[model samples]
Target: MFAFYDLETTGTSPAFDQPLQFAAILTDNDLNEAERVDIRCRLAPHILPAPWALAVTGISPDQLVDPDLPSWFEFSHQISDLIKRWAPATWAGYNTLAFDEEFLRQSFYQNLHPNLYQTQFANNDRLDLMKVIYAVRDREPDALKWPLDDLGRESFKLDRLAPENGFANHDAHDALGDVEATIHIASVIRKHAPAVWDQCLLNRDKHEVDRLLQSGHPVCLIERFGAAQPRSYFGVFAGTNPQNNNSVAFLDLDLCDASIIDANDQDLAKAVAASPKLIRTIAINKAPNVFPVANPRSAHGSLAQLVSAHPEFHQRVGQALANRYADKEPAQHVEQLIYDRFYNAGDKRVLEDFEVADWRDRAQIVAQLDDLRLKQLGMRLIFSNAPEFAPKKYRSAASAAIRDRWLTKEPSTPWTTKAIVEKQLHEIVCGEVLNMDQICALQDFYHARISEIDI
Candidate 1:
């Protein structure tokens, strides 16, 4: 199963930002649609969207506040239910793992759902079209006609790429429109480069990762940046991730050399952790765009030569990583655990229960759970699912806890007050920065709420 999805949010900060609209197209392995979901939620009472974000989405304050629209909490439940119904599917979209996945995780966390398991459990995994594009560009530039931005650099933005490739992306920023575009792009990739697509598609299975690491060959490791273009590195299997058995470690062969094997335990540990000094590891759940090195770059030649000549290189690298993370505490943060490959039997049972439980019963059951980790998880669920049902003090404390975790203070109170509305209205008309389309959208927004507010 593959669920191609996209989201339009209040801003870029996943912790502080909230999704205003959610959309997905559920499909089988062949790319035939199974179902489609598109939802728009009333802006959360506490969220104050960035002006540029609002302008891009063209979602007015009036539309967000309309009684006809579902509340954020209600909409979150719908999103969660739909996602659960399509569980264990590969979640693919343009830049989704880096952006939309975070929004979805926070939504589940804030809505009392077991946010952790949904993306990782049942062999579920994720793929990024953006990374795929970069990999193809590097390996076979002629495989697909890559689009370029105004500056003549490769442009992977969905809106631009869709039209360039004959995919219809109506209303670029609209959640459903973007989902359609993503699915179209993915379909084309599957058609033109099935081998590359299959290779890059991540698998949550630990054995699969182990097999890759044990292969003793360099693989293409790809990473994409939000601001910069994608970069690819040649990496070789080094060892098992010390923290997660399900994850295999890799040494950036391009950055390492023969001198590594002579290093002591302490020196090797320090070297593994240091950037540009050699080794890097990622979990199966958070795997990147990786493929077999079919056409190695010139820079990869040196590492390839070294590995071909040195039989003991990997063994030494493995020992170094083990020494580095030996006594370190396990990561406690959700972000850190996204890449976690290992989950004990008890953890698996908890996740299974979470999946099978009736949505209404989850909060209460979690609240009464005894395990410290389970207790912490349940508290988040209770606070997100039904704050009114929780003790008032508990609710306040929960909110404070999330705020501290996000490292954000609440924005100014009464965000929709007359002054703010008037200021937005003025920005629509008199502001020098906004383009005509944005100004027009903002003006229409102001006109829509003329009867409700003085602004």
Candidate 2:
């Protein structure tokens, strides 16, 4: 089974911004649709919608605060339920692993959903069609018609790519429309490049990827760096990260020599961190574009065999991986702390219960939570959903904080503040090619939003 999904969000920061829309199509193994979901939610009161984002998506002011739509909390529950209902399937989307997956994880985390990794847990896997497209472009260039951007460069944007390949009436940015187009593209891949499709499916399982990488054989790794075209390298697994098994180091045989095994600790660490890297760090869980090298280079094969025999070298590489990020600062925001630690089993159960509990009982449930982050998030949810049920002090403080957050003029703040939105609206009006009516409406929306902040 495959679940092709897409999201239309207020902004790009998965930590601060929230999803305003989520659309998905559930398909069988052959990519035939089984069911679909299109959901939208009213904006969280603390969020100031990015004016450019609103303009780009064509989401009107009325939609942001729709009285008929569910709160973001309810919207999270609905999507979480859908994920649970459609378990044991490959969750896929165009560029989802890079963008939508983080948003989904953050959404679930902020809304007190018990499992932040719902797509990866419970027999579920993930596939990013965009990543698959990169692999197909490298291995099966004749499989699909590739589109080019205005600069005549190869374009992978869904809006252009789908139409280039014969998906008529592509809806560009709308969530459901993008989902349908993604499904069409997937169908094309399966039909024209069955081998590439099958390889992608096999790589979706991290364990399978781990096994292949550890098999002491040369593999072809397809990757794109910055604006460069995708390139293939003959690599062998150097080591796995001691701190995170999902991150594995692959040595590009074409770039580094076998003598790397004899390097000292400091030298090995430097080599791992070098620019035009001697080692490529891959997120095994992100469905890395790695495949069996069909025609292995004799020299590369010899290097792989030499590196495979040196177990001590692999250990040193793992040590290098562990120390790579040891000096980085810890994240300060609650949103950034989603991966700081996993929820305890006790708190997880309480959260599960909190979801189904009545509003009146939710405050008590929040108090029962052992995790401080959950308690804070749960209290905020209660204050937002049913303020009268919360204690007066918390209600007052939360309201004041919301006001301060909106009215804050700190230029370095991560979220979309009122000041930021005002500047963005000014830029859009002056620079964008919109008519007078549209400009007036945007200004009206901005003022209306500001008036509600109560600062």
Supply every candidate's count of residue pairs whose N, Cα or C atoms clash at under 3 angstroms. Answer: 0, 0
Residues 146-239, model 1: lDDT tens digits:
7889989878788888888778535799888888888887788778877767777643344565666566667767765555666776787666
Q: Looking at candidate 1, what is the lDDT of residue 380?
A: 58
Each prediction's RMSD over C-alphas, in Å, is 6.3, 1.4
lDDT of 2 at 147: 90
> Candidate 2 residues 1-455, lDDT tens each?
89899999888889889999999999999888899999999998767778888888888778988989999999988998898899988999999998999999988998899999999988999999998888888989899998999999998889999999999998878999999999999999999999999999999999899999999999989988776777787899999888999998899898888689899999878878998888879899999898988678899999999999999899899889888889989998788888988899999899989988999999899999988888888898888889899999998898888788788889988888888888888888789656777878878977887787674
Q: Identify the runs in model 1 with alpha carbons over 4 angstroms from their true place.
A: 202-206, 224-231, 265-270, 273-277, 294-455
Candidate 2 regions with alpha-carbon error over 4 angstroms: none
Best by lDDT: 2
Number of the predicted model whose TM-score against the real structure is largest: 2
Per-candidate local distance difference test = 0.67, 0.89
Residue pairs clashing, model 2: none
